[model samples]
Target: MIKNNNIDNIGGMEFATFRLKEGVTETRLVELSHQVEAEFLSQQEELILHFLVRGTDGVYADVAIASSQEKAEEYCQQWLRNKVALEYLELLDKESVNMTFWSKIN
Candidate 1:
């Protein structure tokens, strides 16, 4: 199993924006989204980040995920390595453990 001591076990959301390649269609985007989701599900609960396909630019995708930052980055990189051409990628921000709404409001 994958293990990272620095990984934040606290569940939260991660937002990422990507630029697509040229001439990529909406139908293809949906298919790609599902593929990415399937890849993510393989990680089990440790990678329980919900992915949302925000939009597509040509052949790129603006995707977002809600999960641990470490896992998210790892997954995203793996995705790029295997899937679409990653023009650029970044970790927008990470919510601290106590910052999670589930924990904050409790």
Candidate 2:
């Protein structure tokens, strides 16, 4: 579904981004982060790199490097549904949430 043909190293890299809801506590985010790290990244064999980053203005980044584009997006959406639910994630635009990937490039 994610067309990565023109991107570099599409086979081994993926990226996701979002914005956190207002009034979301740091402690809550930490707890969710721990749960995600333990349950998904640690348990899922297909995911080699997975991280959630929060930037200024509540911007968030959900990055992953997996075996394929579908796997990468599937993993991200699964995590979001199980962890943050659908209501909290804010999309700036349809395109900004698009993921970018990279690999060893050998």
Candidate 3:
């Protein structure tokens, strides 16, 4: 877990960066993200914010901020098993995945 006072209004954060599989377009990614949000994330009451961001290096990050560190960890575990989340993960390159959880101190 990350501990830094510079961060504020955050209890915990999940940061996952990866590259999409070959031939997967951003349009399909966004469409699947909506499904993940509705079917998985929305069910987590502790989830504060969630979004997908892209970098110039052709990598994308799936970010989720939660109300607590435990909730953040829980979400990460659940994400791996959730049907919609699994479907979403299918678009990403498995070997390129890097996921971590951080705890804020502020």
Q: lDDT of each prediction vs. the true structure?
A: 0.42, 0.58, 0.85
User: Residue 19: error of model 3 in Å?
Assistant: 0.3
Q: Rank the candidates by lDDT, best first.
A: 3, 2, 1
Two-way TM-score contest, 2 vs 3, winner? 3
Better of 1 and 3 by lDDT: 3
Cα deviation at 74, candidate 3, in Å, is 0.5
Off by over 4 Å in 1: 1-12, 53-67, 81-106
lDDT tens digits by residue: candidate 1, 3-92: 323335544344544443445455665665565555544554555444444544322324333255555555545655654323122221
Q: What is the C-alpha RMSD of each candidate to the true structure, in Å?
A: 9.5, 7.2, 4.9
Poorest 10 consecutive residues of model 2 by lDDT? 84-93
Model number with the top TM-score: 3
Reference-based TM-score, model 2: 0.58
Which stretches of candidate 3 lie above 4 Å from their native place? Answer: 1-9
